[model samples]
Target chain A: MKLKSLAVICLGLLISACAASNDQAASSGSASGASAGSNSGQLSRDVTTTTSSTFAPGSQEELQASIGDRVFFETDRYDLSPEAQAMAGTWADWMKKHQNVQIEIEGHADERGTREYNLALGARRANTVKDYLTSLGVQANRVSTVSYGTERPDALGSNEEAWAKNRRSVAVVR
Target chain B: MARILKILIPLVLILSAFKPAMSQLRVSVEDGLREPLPIAFAPFVTKNGASPNMGRDLADVAIADLESSRLFRAIDPSAFIQTPAAATIAPRFPDWRQINAQALVVGTVGNEPDGRIRVEFRLWDVLGEVQLVGQAYVTQRENWRRISHLVADTVYKWLTGEKGYFDTRIVYVAESGTADRKVKRLAIMDQDGANHSYLTNGRNLVLTPRFSPSRQEITYMSYAGRRPRVRILNVDTNQDETLGPIDGMTFAPRFSPDGDKLLFSAEQRGNSDVFALDLRSRRRERLTDHPAIDTSPSFSPNQREIVFNSDRGGTPQLYVMSADGGNARRISFGGGRYATPVWSPRGDLIAFTKIEGGQFGIGVMRSDGSNEKMLSQSYFEESPTWAPNGRVIMFFRRTPTDRKGRGGRSRLFIVDVAGGEPREIVTPGDASDPAWSPLSP
Candidate 1:
């Protein structure tokens, strides 16, 4: 019985190993991801690339680098800060310039909260950004919102500094 | 030659026909073993061209399972005073008594005519000099581990007077990559961590997998469409569908005792509330209308009531309400915040995860939220699921990563409900969010 179980277990291990390697294959495109390629290659490479030379006057690259395509929020609270409000105003203006392009607003949260709550909090944060943009005259149809909760953190630590950076929402051009 | 063989066959049969008188000693569940019972596990004797080391290997798995319960200490085989000579043979109690073993397990493995393995084992009370129990099981060679679990369960129940949880499985999230960008996939494995397999390809994040009481299905939260939503998957068929275009993010899902309904938290415009949905009719009912986070809803075994975690009182705590969602009452007043409250199958206690003094631990309390006792503590531990018998809990523990959270791994652990050290459950990969399934029919 033990020999039989060992064979089954060995087969299971082999299948899981293959699954892990397949994940590596699928995530290998992330080696050139923005600001996340230094160590364990895991960050999504799904973000669109906008080179400096090919950057339009109001493209994602220019907006992200200058006006900031992201805004931070208080812990467990989705209200925008004064600086965040200013950034949101700039983001609205950029949306106006690129009216033809739609955007997805992703809300995120720190690790201190439960996954479900953080998800709701993230949605609130993303919607807060979207509401500010719509109030500033960007069409509601042009902006969609989703929350990743703490699943995709901008910073990866348990410390206050990392948590602060993680409790924010980013605007991705869709 | 035929006459000579007939004489030799009878001689061999008589030589091996050594069975002790059938006697029984009853052990009661009320007389729980306060200290780990010392037991000797004799290697099974193999015969008829069975794998030479099959008996020893089977014994190893049985010993590991028994020891993991923390109720039985498997005495090292090196100290064994006697060994078995054939299948269906009894152990000499005096030899086991000499080694200070209060209980002993002896077994043998042999190849059958139909290309299968037959395992037979017996449990003996050393001090009382009586046979406690015995059984023989025949199956394909590939099912040895299951045979081992059955053996452990038999031994455990005979000695402890409680149903054992060895023959069960756990579903969890298999995680990979750095902390910032984790790839979480839904995975399932045997309780002892064998036959590990991924249900999802990790294309999307999955969390909080739960098994249905009457179905081979799982309800969990997935970001498959890049949106947080409740999804159900048939583990056997690998088919899945989303539950609701629920106004917003839906998560922390659990199935009702009957498996016909599901309870989960749905957050719309930042207000999270618990809701129930009927599987067949696809009718949705709001269970909690609180403006605060009310998640982790679990149903009692009887399905008469529900226990969930809510932060409506400013801090996360446990609350109980009728299955119909009225007359809600707060039941937790412990020092720390509690979350992920799951009712036990035994219908007496609710298991929960506690956050106190900046550390996370697993604990249990009466169904009415009294007599709370901490079972295990660590840097990060949560998501306690009860074994079918409600005598054990399985959870996941995460190691602290660097200051940047650059590296950390999560693994599953199990502990007896009576409070003992949690032992790690070996898996092929980093794992979390374990849910124990009910005993298979």
Candidate 2:
């Protein structure tokens, strides 16, 4: 069983690497075409103008599209359901378009676990996302991870709805 | 000799008068003989050029500071008959005496010539019909809250014959979010949990924040940038500098008694050992060379010896060692795993968390780890911090909830080290990892 799981993780890594290479090829082609039209002296100034819209534009729309569909797991568990996998694909597609933009994936937990253990669990949750995104061909350096360890909450009520909303790893524009 | 005799005669008379009522006095070992003295806090009178609510605001803050200590029951304003206008203006003793009030606190909040608030108050012993203490302070309008706590501290010291804890602060970990994606931030607040401000942005997990002897700096463990290292943070400047980099995880940090050295545990491979780093020289010394886990090191009052927790003897127990890392001795022989041992500021005892039979408890023992007394028991409890006086301990407790984990709530609590009923301190959200600051000078 352990060997099978390891093989699955390796396959996921290969898929993510292939997808990342295809994205790089598309971006580099556009960069070369743009550079051919502008002289070297003017390229640096126009580069910022081109990359700003290339990276973060339409990010909010893409993030909103995945809202309410994703579900978080208990600490240290990374197996994704059909719904979460669908949401992860949407996030992966969003990253494919905004290749130049770096994002931070933050993981959080409720206040039931011990402090250090919760931190490690939050890290594992973030790493799960990072691994899945990497398998979808996103660059690892472009995605940083942080864990709040049950400190910041999106909802204030102590009900299930609040807990569900809080136990999530969010993709934030860095 | 004649002047001394004159003072001795009234002292003798007062002692004689109290002899008949001595048996009626019920003083618990924890709180001593004095009943929570009932004092009346009449709304301070506001004079010309002062803010309309200044008087009421000062009085309200003063009352809160006094009440938070679980001492001094302030009488309702409706119970007062007359208010004092000046120190020389004697209170109507009969009016207060009729309401069973033993002491009366009267004050005025007015504008001073220098554009500051001048608050003057007098504590009158209604039964004796004499003023026990009187003082005035000039401060900016924004500092009225601090002025109120100072006033309360003065009254507390005068009445109890001990210094007050009102003018202090607390550093703790404020928790939020869900069980899977939670965020913990390093937060500091007034002793009453007011004026709360976060020191870290919840980007990392921070724990065990200890105030320096100067109360200006904090040493805590943080996983910022995913590095489990110890860092020294200056509260005033918001500047943090990482201590010397060690190969493995470093945690369970505390300042030396003189605040010149920091003692903490550094986990290398899987073996954790106690080490001290000099703040000035940036030099490091290994205090315990044992193969067992040694953590939670604290300095004795003179900084010559250190007390810490170790699993060297098969179970986690308290151990003491010299500052130079020699002559180590096991101090705790009790049946439990003890962690987070903190030497009291008074240098008489060490406070720690004891785990026995799957239940956690807060307890204290003598310097040699004898006379262990459990002050509180709960399903989950850790981190026992002492108030400066060492009379009370403030720790975190979590209640067991239902299957949905709905009722599990973590809150800070304080209990007398003498083992009395514990009192819950209310906070907005779940709070934990409490570190009580030394009394502010």
True contacts kept of each: 0.52, 0.03
Q: CA shift at A134, candidate 2, in angstroms?
A: 28
Least lDDT summed over 10 consecutive residues: which range in candidate 2 chain A? A61-70
The structural similarity of chain B in model 1 to the true chain B, as TM-score, is 0.91
How well does candidate 2 score on lDDT at residue A72? 66
Please give, for residues A62-81, the per-residue lDDT of candidate 1 as tens digits.
Answer: 44433345677877788777
What's the lDDT for residue A143 in model 1? Answer: 87
Expressed as tens digits, the lDDT of each residue in A13-88 for candidate 2 is 4443223322322232223224323232343233334435322353432233212113466433445544455445
What TM-score would each prediction reach against the true structure?
A: 0.84, 0.68
Report clashes for each candidate as comma-separated counts: 0, 23
Which residue runs of candidate 1 sit more than 4 Å off their true CA positions? A1-54, A135-137, B1-33, B86-88
Q: Please give the range of 10 consecutive residues that has the lowest summed lDDT in model 2 chain B.
A: B4-13
Best by TM-score: 1
